[model samples]
Target chain A: MVDSVTTINSDGSRYFLYPADARGRFSLARRLSAYGLIVVYLLLPWIPVGGHPAVFIDIAERRFHFLGYTLAAQDTWLLFFGVSGLGFALFFLTALFGRLWCGWACPQTVFLDHVFRRIERWLEGDAVARRALQLAPMGPSKFARRAVKHLLYFFASLLITHLFLAYFVSLPELWLFMRAAPGEHWAAFLFVFIAAGLLYFNFAWFREQLCIVICPYGRLQSALTDDHTLVIGYDARRGEPRGRAGTPAAGACIACNRCVQVCPTGIDIRHGLQLECIGCAACIDACDEVMTKIHRPLGLVRYDSLAGLTGGVTRWVRPRTILYGGLLLLGIIVATFAFSSVQPANFLIYRMSGAAYFVGAEEVRDQFMVRIVNKRPTPATFTVSLEGLPAGMRQTGFLAPVTLAAQEELVSPLILLIDRKYYHGAFKFTVKVADAARTFSLARSVEFMGPDANLLTEDDHEKHRHR
Target chain B: MNSQPQPPHGPEAEPALRPHSYDGIREYDQRLPNWWLNTLYGAIVFWIAYWFVYMIAGLVPSDGAQVDAAMARIEATKMASSIDVTNDDKFWEMSTNPVFVEAGKQTYNSLCFPCHLASLRGKSENPTAIGPDLTDTAWIHGGTPKEMYVTIKNGVIAKGMPAWDPVIGQKKASEVLAYILSYHKKGGTITLQAP
Candidate 1:
């Protein structure tokens, strides 16, 4: 009832009548808007802020910043979990809805429907012009139209290629190379150039073949979907017992096949659910317009499950969806906790050097190196000390202590010397580092290596100590 | 339904395909396209190359190893810069003078106070458990200055303590050693023990 009106243009002319096959629904401007949206999307990753590349996957640096968070190499497991969670989420959604992602949000489908379709309409005219032009004989006018179409395609393709590069290589670097002479950046320029041409050719010409054969998601739909899953399906029961409403027998499906015509994937919804149907709702829009004209209820062709059409409830809360959602929620909580609990930096402890060996006097000397990592966005200072060392052992590295710059690592090594009389056995020492205020201590343990022979016997040590 | 007569057919005409057409759309069996197959093969090739370069070559170390190596390098480099003549004064200075003890205490507070605490209290989270409780008499390593110096220099790697040979030289080790020894003879209530 919300959209139950069926009216037409001014005048009582039947020329604009509705029940006739709906033609010229999509105008030239509307089509171009679709193409322009894609161009804008492709260009976003390359647009830079400040000197930094807007999006960088500097895997070599072991630091990747997507929006702004600098994910270090240590966060690789988090990446793994994140990707897995995403993959499962996609699977669950697809299993329940049947190519909903492909229809509405997939980059591939959006670009093809909007960009490629617009370009095609521009070159060959509307659907009628396109069909007529296909049968037209070779002539200067035809050649000119064809040439213009392809030239635009190539230009659009070039833009796509550059944007893809920006996603990986970062926009700032690309801009620097672009600003230089062609000779200076021939390698980069050439790669982007070829990439654009390839993308253009793929989206412009190859088109629907990508969904049918290349995409695994389409193939996996059969495995993911069931009778209860909703998809763009023709109500074969109603549509089958179908004929023109104005005709002698009016079940109201005149079988005009306009739904098939507008489908980007070139599949007929009337044939029931097919993998080729991206569920773009183009057919729905087309059929709805037809129904309105023919004075029949809308939704003769609509999103519905096989079970629903077969006189069963749609069942909004399926068991599979609930299970998948629970797993996804659990994964999200774990990932959140892992991310929050991570220390902002590394904690380190080192043995002092030159204390490793004893001189002719039989003194043992060894050396050590200690380092601290500051993972904050600003500079931080930390105090370092040794713990769990034997009663007499201590650390000797710092005089004024050290401060680490933002994302910096500071290393300091110390030396320890032991008299032969004190040489007992290997002992463990714990190293503790704290921020300048000594509020939080990050601790680790290390051993003090020394000769066991010089250690006083247990009884001797006790006797000597008592004195 | 019979308003229009059927058109004449040629001798090789095929039978009407029934039960198939919905609103005049005839289904035809068409195989998958060639371009798709080619692209899939191309992706496989790219994947193989990536796998070889990144996984088989061992070019990238694990994240944990990288962190450990980075800390070790920093420690080594720092110790190399601090070696000097400070050890001789400590050896001869008899270090028991309150002047020396106060100086040592200042140094300890500034440098070691974070882990050991201003009260010589031990922290629980220290990975190495570096500073023992000064109040306890358990001298796992002897309480002598020389023993303290050696323990400071040659850190135990297995327990997470780095050898500080690169940051502090032999001389600085001795000064800190003298500082620790001063604590031993002084009538301080602090004792070394477990936290």
Candidate 2:
């Protein structure tokens, strides 16, 4: 088969295919794994952990609830770590085995190969029937089948869109949105329909083009793979010098072309290490079946590195693999450290925006606004008191023991009054907050207008003599 | 199974076409795909350019700038209009306007309420309360409305008062001045709140 990404068949005709269904141990293994993955994807959104949806990323409110932990928008850096970790892992895996992800668990491949293809096969029958149906003229019977198939595609697309939306919105919010009139949330309405359209287009039309042309991972795998990297390939050394029916051949290859017909990405395995090979092991199963029928030794096409085929050794502890592995480990460690030590509370103090310092009848006053974020699972009630402050520095507003709900943020206004005796210039003091149970405490220091020791040595004799 | 394994490529007359073995796999002497190389190098070049434009040159603001911009957005959204104290015309015009004075009063009450007291009637005998009363004719720095505006904008450094213009922005300073001037008592009855 031609390796080039084109719609034309090798015989120079339009290539529209219903690839012959693969029935091998590898195919069975993949189908079972896809079932498990699809179940997990469907169930994750509804599962509640620590009173939050399992993996909700509430962008509007700036809160991410991952598994059992709730993180604020301030912790967005963690997402960077998570994404980079995935990237590094991909690199490491690609260096070890070529295109393993593209075939087995890639979302695009999984949905099309396992979900969409199954539905198509069940509806239209096998490869011969599917091809015949496509060629047949429009009639009542055909129109009815076509309509039902498209309706099923629409429903499947809808289900996928629901799952995708559930990640950003809580299950309850999603239900509410669903029950409301579409016009109320115009943007969301548009997004859901647009996503469905894209999914339909991808599954029905784009298909293998996603792997052959659009996917950067295929290109990346080629770049990362050396001769030692493992990949599924036909053993051209054993399988070559094709044997025709009723003709003796030097090589084992019977030239039945079962491997070519079973391929998903539509590439011949005999062509050494093409970019389109997804390492799904479908051809290996098909070739092994053919070899079994011919009463020959198995593994005409198999999972092996080019080095292994060429009489070389495979090194698992190479420098490039170790480098990728080391970085992946480091990323995980740093992420764990950060997640474990996430601050339970964050506090900030700003001198009130408008006025400088106020002179009261009995004291010199300075107003401040305190902002606090409760970064814990439970509701927090904390009493704010001043530290490193001289005696007679009292506060009136904001009765102590401020309470906030779980993941709540509060801004409080307060007045600090220094008794007439202690109006020192810019006195430094700490604003401390302690939980009512005294379980935890956080502090932030601030400057207030108070007696400056410099006042005693004032060169401003006129103001000093008046005092 | 042949007696010995044979290489896949046909007998190559040209050295360039000959498949060389490394670690057992036959290595085809081919360069990496252009797309992959371009993308890898593009990210490197982009990162350097990003560093030059944002971090080193400071053309784009960092985290602090983002916070400041957010604050400025909030400031713009506030009930009061953007105050321009740089121009003397806008300063005095806003000072006399009742609306500006009202906005200033709101700002003063929240920001200055801790020290100045809600009444704006300061005490002279006690050092802590010894701040000159706004209502009283006697002025520590200058008595005129313009002088008070300047003093409030650029505070008396020797004294504890901070320069509010930079912190609260200039227009708000003029508003505070207007609020203060509105009650610059001309020997009237002291309108003090109950203490």
Candidate 3:
């Protein structure tokens, strides 16, 4: 390698260091990436976040608790809007840049990069050794390595499958099922088996095909991205008219092909950006190594927009990006405010039967249904009362205060009877809920219907008084 | 129109075509197959037969079944209402009912004897019977008929009282409420004592 440092000018910045070289084999990186996919994909579900599974989609109770927020079926529309907003934002981000998520933030990419690579490196050795092992005939060395690697991979895949189950059915419940006898929880066992099988098949064999074909996000990325978005690109201007290092003046174009050797997807960046490229910066690392050896400037391959490379008119402000970003911020604010404004507990009131309005041997009376919910971890009692009604109106069934156990709901049927003379049309009443510590109130209005005023005569009143 | 030569494996191997029609609109012949038609016909025939037997012929279930279904609906509604912790329809009813209030006073004097004392006045030893001060409007649970029903049914297991749901039943939970609610306006008296 040359002693002098190389400098490449792109995006109005100077790079003093050269890119990395293809010291690691492409096959090794691929195998390693595969192994990483196994570990992360397996462990993701099992990883607990605040005593809860990282991911869960509980659709049965019409309650979905993702992370910590318990979303009721009523909140399904809110979730839908949030998801759509996220999708739009992602689309906008991708349109400006090609396959950025595919290489970086995507779970699939992150898993494959961090988990599989480490495992593969541990088992089959580095890129070159793995490639050599692949090429080797059926011998003891190959057999040992292959057996150990396959066993490790399968175990990792199994762990990943378990974690996936934990995400859907809470870890505690799943753990109980696992601890039970095999025949006892046949349904649970079946679920675990099938889910694990799917996960194992995915990471073990599906691999890159998942990113290229199965993932719709990658396909949609092409539609969202414009030529202006920053992407990993090869400076065909400098690196072309390709020839060896000691050849005639052919620019800085050293056709070493290290860039190709290091690429995980096996695509030539020099051919310009393609859908298959994950933009992993491996090519940058590789080409930098080549530049160092030849004592030339680096960054034959780098991240840049078309405008940036061409040195033409470039505007940083893109309408779609700005709009999507603004919307995302707005959604976040709304979600935050909604969660902050209301305590998790909720209350509902309904009128009961067997009475309408009055208290006598023969009188009209009304019955109501009142419900209290305690959302806290500890059991609590709520003092409930009514407002916006006349002073004579009273709730007669419950103790002065109603206590609810932790996460418990109390339903009370009450009787409300106003004197026939006093009872009338629609009335609005507010139900106030209070613990010893704090109070929350909700209001509801209901119409009171009864027989006409003529239904009760002076004689009827006299009979009721005698009774 | 002239016949176009087919490109040998280019990006566009198939040429896009426009249909000819009398109007501006043209349509594609996409129709359900015979098997699908047969399945649909079978479904319709089955539905008609089922409807004739169940509705027209009066050959379905009895009135008892209808009653059972109604009961089931009531039970389901109760369960749904139970899941909600903030509803107090029963309490509201009791609060408004003088008779229930009278019944509640009776229950309070009987059940609340040892701890709450005879006058509905709280005792230092029992100290409100391991419960809230019924006389005070500041209730720990609530002051509604429904709330009273629930508290009586499911006693504070965390506190001293056992959950009465298994023992007393929901109807009696209301009776217990009546007894306790009687003490709401009356406390600090040595009115009744247990034998």
Q: Which runs in model 1 stand beyond 4 Å of their true positions?
A: A1-55, A137-139, A181-187, A248-250, A347-366, A398-401, A414-424, A434-442, A453-467, B1-32, B36-195
Q: So what's the TM-score on candidate 3?
A: 0.62
Regions of candidate 3 where Cα sits further than 4 Å from its true position: A1-78, A95-98, A125-132, A168-172, A353-363, A425-428, A457-467, B1-195
> Can you rank all candidates by DockQ, best first?
2, 1, 3
Worst 10 residues of 1 chain B by lDDT: B1-10
Say which prediction, candidate 2 or candidate 3, comes out ahead on TM-score.
2
Better of 1 and 2 by DockQ: 2
In model 3, what is the error at residue B49, expressed in angstroms?
Answer: 30
Per-residue alpha-carbon lDDT of candidate 1 for residues B115-147, written as tens digits (9 for 90 to 100): 455566443334333445543455544444445
Model 1 per-residue lDDT tens digits across residues A1-467: 00110111112111111111223333333345555667657655755543345566665466566555556666677886679788778767876787878876677766666666567776776666775676799899999988888888888777677777677666767788779998898988889887877778777666666676578988888877888888877776667666655666556578776775666554556767776777777777778887887777888778788788666777757877787777778888888898776665677665443335432232445656677777665688877776565544444455455787877876645545455466577667676787887646688877767655544355457767889
Worst 10 residues of 1 chain A by lDDT: A1-10
Residue A33's lDDT in candidate 2:
91
Question: Which candidate number has the best lDDT?
Answer: 2
Mark the regions of model 2 whose C-alpha exceeds 4 Å error after superposition: A1-3, A6-14, A244-249, A358-365, A383-399, A417-445, A449-467, B1-195
Model 2, range A182-228, lDDT digits (tens) per residue?
99877777898899988987888667866776788888876688887
Predicted complex 2: DockQ: 0.06
